[model samples]
Target: MSSESTVLIFGGCGFVGFHLVRHFVKTSTFTSVAVVSRSAANHDNHVDGATYHSGDLTDHDSIEQLLLKIKPTIIIHAASPSPVTGTPNEYEHVTIQGTKNLLKIAKRSKDVRALIYISSSALAKGPEHVNLDENHPLANTDPKSSAYARTKALADLMVLEANNPFPFSEPSVKETSWEGHLLTASLRFPIVYGTHDPTTIPGCLSALQKGQIAFQLGSGKNLWDFCSIENVCAAHSLLVQALLNPKRSPGAAKVDGEAFNIHDGSPHLFWEFARTVWKFAGHRPKNDKVTSLPAWFVLALASFLEWGYWIVTLRTKRPYNLGRQQVEYACFTHTYSIAKAKERLEFTPKQDFEGGLKEAVTWSLKQDHWDEKLKHVTLTN
Candidate 1:
């Protein structure tokens, strides 16, 4: 990586991609930072130094035209249809086929040197598991898995499989192994949240504000891992650096062709996360005390709703909220090991968890001048 190196991010306007564009631009590492997204023309929060291009990943001509035009030295892909949308067709075409198209064109490009794909830990086996890692076989292929899981797992494997072979020996000395080689790697993230988070944090706060979160869904004991968006951004930057100088990286093998599981490392009780949002936002459940719903009962009812919805809609649309997956997630424990990331890329959460929560809440409050009402309140508890 040098001053002349150029980087392009797919879905650069997205929650993850735009932050990445901001990250690369702030570092000033790449002279040219370009963002390619389907909705580029409508995005207004454009970073000053970076350029935005309208492109579709699922279209070969779209991908071909962009790659030929940009000729990026480092390509970071953070694009995927959001899980909340639950649009299986978009998941199939954009995440699965779209990644296929990007790789086919990128691998043949003489100027491209590195490719990093953002993948999801949802592909990990669901329920009754702890510290799931890259070796977990991407066990999301279970019969109940959604189209999202299947597409992500398939695309995740494809990106890693495209890596160039590198000497796996540790380096007592540093070396440049990136020239003329289009190395690829993947980062699997779990439940990312932070300031400006359009999905998770805002959704929870909105539901809380509306007094929709009436009761606990499960035992409220399951430990869920969350990665701050800043930490995720930092991890991508470090992995990009590690891939550039892997031999010098304090690890046994080059980061090429490997996937890393990353999170904030401290898994909190599942309900505690939502409670923190309420706590910081100076709100509480409509009820004075939260009560638990029977996990098995909820799961069964969700199954019935999912089946009924699918039948009524002829499977064109999924449930807006209640589903088997949602119930199961509420009931089960989900955590992943970041040991590989720590060892290989020296990646650590840069944003402290407590502070990140406060920042997220404060930002949300500032949106409505809600902060002025509770300046004395803080996260002392």
Candidate 2:
């Protein structure tokens, strides 16, 4: 609300976190920004006016010290274990326990006014459905859900349940003098892709380069949802603004202890979108070069791979690139409705599919692994 309000972003050096930090520093009215990261190595990427604090989320004392020193008015929790890592223990430690620690510290802080959590749509249970919304049940009890999903669902519950208003019946030991409540909300993001993305874009490009993406798993017509990095950052900005100015926000009642799904508001056939990226990246999906496979066949293969990897890595933890969940994502339609976000947070995608794809391709081209020979490659269609 006030220009003097300080915002603290956890995982500030990460892909989404860095963009969020930049968004607040350069675009939003918030003048004071501090980023808490596991390492300050990316401090150079932070904007001129932003401050960086190095701290580990897993360490209670470390996070507490940082919170006490910064005394931030707003806190954005974006740090979590990488989805690609597929380490269950790591997800539990960083996502569940780390959030618990932050909540404990935040509850004690008199200055903290709002807390925004960055979550995932993987918490959706059952088969992929169209227009899934906030009322959809979380997949915490789903046996088939990924380790990341289960852990995140738990963390999401904890965050929403921790939202306590002022004049609380039970107050924290350090917050006796505080007058206001700790406002909290969560944003569940779908496949987020954009420049500096460490997951989606790079993984797809690497598979394409290696010729591993030689086939479409299903009809290539399954609709999927994606949220651009810019949109993700924009949603965070809107959430922060709403928390700061509740009466002015149109959907103020929906701001507290709420979770909203964020996407580009456009759904596309899975492989069609992939083909667009491939074409833009100087590659053509030829009929001969790329084969089409039945979804059942791919699912069978994925199951075999999952079992084989489990046996092979019995004593160790290794990320399996192909699994049942990956196959389900590729074969099913899973588009979420962002009506709540649009109404409540005034969230909108700043870039369309084509624009975001072009930006991603342009960014990818500048990477060191980009082949010069592929520069002039053109689409056959």
Candidate 3:
């Protein structure tokens, strides 16, 4: 709230966390900003004003010591393994147990005021979640969901349930007279894309370079939600402001122990968005360049590939990317409602779909993978 407040971001060296560090350093009034990562030695994109601490969330003693040393007023939990590539053990250790450790430490830490978690829309289950909201049932109960999703859902529940005004009955510290409770909340982001995105946009560029972007999954009629990196950073700032502001009314009540979906506020057809990005990246799509296939056929192929990869990697630990989840993401129509985020956190998307795509494409053009043959192509018209 004030310049005295210290904000600490876990997983600060990561894609989203890097943007968050820059946002806090450039925009936030908080005096002290620190990022915790497993190893901060060679972090390439370090911000000027923020501090980086080498720590591991799985190491409970290290985290406890770091929290005691820094005494941060706000803790932003953004550290987690990649949803597509991480193993079950990594998810359990870093996402579930690590979050539990943080909750345990924050409950007794007097200076800590708020704990903001970065969650995913994958927590919602079933095809019926076309317009998912906070009340949607979590996928943690579903056995068929990915290990990452289930563990993250469990962590989300822990953070929300730990949001008590009174400290836990069994305090971590007995002699301390400080008795402040921690406020907690979470923001669910959908397919975040921006300059430094290591996932969606890069994967698209790879497909385009390999000439594999010609086929559309199903009819490409599915509308999906995407969150711009800038918008995600803005939502975090707005929620933190609401959580720390005492003068703010009961409207802020919706934020405590609550989860809000943040997106670009515009859902776009899957193929249309893909073609737009391709066009912006200097690849012009022709009528024959793009084709559609039945969703069932593609899903079947994905299942086969998954089975083959699992059998081949019986002894190794390699991960397969093309699977049922990828098929579902390509063909499913799941858009989140950002009305709660807007009303509660006063959050509005700063960049629309085209603008965000333009930024991402501009960045992509400068990368080494940009095709020289279509260098003159533009998103205009």
Candidate 4:
């Protein structure tokens, strides 16, 4: 806890919260940044010393009046939803009632100190065959898990039981606080590419500019792990300065309610990261002659189109809004373990996952749907 620090950012105009409000507005250790966002052009109003506050994280009195008017000292929950307009009850209404209304407004923001949270390496574990970590094992009954991994494993156990100390006098807890409050952390990430990737490569380049690709499912040798949106915002600013300086990690109280796995600990495969985005997008496309399939026949055709969108939303009464976790994340395969964020958050992922997929395929081949049969399917896949 040094000089300037007043962070607050819940989904700060998204895409990794707009690269964490442009790295906390070019940090000098953020002196006030507020954000909240539900609209107001989705916030990121060019962050310098930030301040946006619109609303809607399950509207608990608009996040308790912006957490009692920006009483922040860091509280970044990067707001969820949008696995295509979410469901599974909108992932239990914004990732578990918007993280219990942002931990009931960070237990009444008593100068909030640290909260972080940003979860999703599909709720701590999954792509096994070895290489997990951060005490992996929260699959929460993985019957091909998703409703965003059981609401991110019930919102990482409500931020580790809201960092105990008799969480509201513990007998079946109920949100009490003070007595050293906000110092919760949980950054499970992965598949978090760069430069504003609104969920997985700009939604796979907006489903290849609305063509809505049909085939090409799995056997693109699964493998996952990826990071860099400035190395996951410099490993969340060195795990919030090793949780506000605990001698910079003398095993910070045996890893305070831990959950690590950020990524880039190398593993690429998905069609060799789609043939280095078709040779760094110098002209390949049409999913470069797409033709792979077999991860149990793409999870048995996405479990028969998730039972044909659950019997066409129970015979078209309503509710369809797509997502079904992209056919169980196109036949899963996450692969993490950044060795406890490179041994207690010293963290080090500089990007070069095939050089950031050739700079997100040379900026998606300079946009306008790079055609020519996608450059002859990128010169023949």
Best by lDDT: 3
Per-model TM against the reference:
0.89, 0.89, 0.90, 0.32
Tell me model 3's lDDT, rounded to 2 decimals: 0.80
Expressed as tens digits, the lDDT of each residue in 93-122 for candidate 2 is 889999999988898887887799999988
Writing each residue's lDDT as its tens digit, candidate 3 over 66-113 gives 999888888999999987777677888899999998888887887787
Position 23, candidate 2: lDDT: 85
RMSD of each: 4.4, 3.6, 3.9, 19.0
lDDT value for model 1: 0.78
Clashing residue pairs in candidate 1 (N, C-alpha, C atoms within 3 angstroms):
none
List candidate 1 stretches off by more than 4 Å: 166-181, 246-252, 284-288, 368-381
Model 4, 278-321: lDDT tens per residue? Answer: 44544244444656666666566555666676587763221222
Report the error of model 1 at residue 268, Å: 0.5
Report how far residue 311 has shifted in candidate 1, in Å: 3.1
Error of 1 at 24 (Å): 1.1
Kindly provide the TM-score of model 4 when superposed on the true structure, using C-alpha atoms.
0.32
Off by over 4 Å in 4: 1-7, 10-14, 19-33, 36-69, 72-74, 77-114, 117-130, 136-179, 198-222, 226-256, 260-271, 274-276, 279-282, 285-334, 337-381
Please give the TM-score that candidate 1 achieves against the real structure: 0.89
Order the candidates by TM-score, highest first.
3, 2, 1, 4
